[model samples]
Target: METNMTLYHGSNIDFEKISLDKAKDKRDFGRGFYTTTIREQAKEWAEILNYRSRRDGCFLYEFTFEKTDNLHIKSFNGITEEWLNFIVENRLKGGVQHSFDVVIGPVANDRTVNTIGLYLSGDYFLDEALRRLEYFKLNDQVSLHTEKALSYLKFIRKYTWTA
Candidate 1:
């Protein structure tokens, strides 16, 4: 499939009321604006977040990567020792500091959440965690990790949730 620069961020709140400043810490790839190439995954995220916020449906916000220049970027092609470590680091309570302005890779979804939790809690080592994650096909995501990267994300449009 042809990848578009356009990406989407889903939330339970309405578009107008959405605020980037309100984002909390201890998130995947740190507290930053996260978008994905897969719309279905965004929908799934919306539905999941909506359940907790008591929002009616998901709000899809579109954005574009404006600066694809010599910007600092990192891409993990697939599940690997390094990829699993990166995800584990970012999701940990203290959080990991990364040099990349943007990081692109698979998401740690519901299926892998517990395994990640196990790894974080010292229940599973790297190899064991990765072995478990390999069972489920992961989805791709792009996360803008710095203000410099976030500045390049230009909002394109908003779509209502009906799916």
Candidate 2:
């Protein structure tokens, strides 16, 4: 129940605007502008993306947003059957699956991606997936899913991780 917090977004390129249209589908939280509460995690993402495309160099954008009762939000504090199913539906369906303006939850990072994949592929059952997921630490992600949600975020600054 954090009301206000700083968030970071790591990207291959720097952009002045945050555009949901450019966001890739089938994401953990569905097509939306994603940020994280962890700075190190965001930096790691920038490094990985930088290694992949080397675009405009690794960039970490900082933003701050305050939670309000006026906006619809979905939050997952930990891995659960509901969280697992939500991710599965979003990944398999390739679009927004809910009406929430923002979603805050545990990210299915590198450690959990394989487990999630196995579950999706039917190689692992729900109970097995949950059991496997417990072995890895999860990161938090804050995704803005609407223009109204996006407006709440105020850009703080941008850090260039690569020269």
lDDT of candidates 1 onward, in order: 0.76, 0.90
> Over the full model, what C-alpha lDDT does candidate 1 score relative to the true structure?
0.76
Compute each candidate's TM-score over C-alphas. 0.84, 0.94
Off by over 4 Å in 2: none
Error of 2 at 100 (Å): 0.6
> After TM-score superposition, what is the CA distance of residue 128 in candidate 2 from its true location, in Å?
1.0
Which candidate number has the best TM-score? 2
For candidate 1, write residues 1-163 as lDDT tens digits. Answer: 2233778888777755334476667676776667897777777778888888776777888777664765688889888888887776777743436888888888888788899889888999988988898989888888876777777777788877643
In model 1, what is the error at residue 163, expressed in angstroms? 7.6
Model 2 residue 108 lDDT? Answer: 91
- Tell how far residue 63 is off in model 1, in angstroms: 2.0
Q: Give the TM-score of candidate 2.
A: 0.94
Could you give me the TM-score of model 1 versus the true structure?
0.84
lDDT of residue 75 for candidate 2? 90
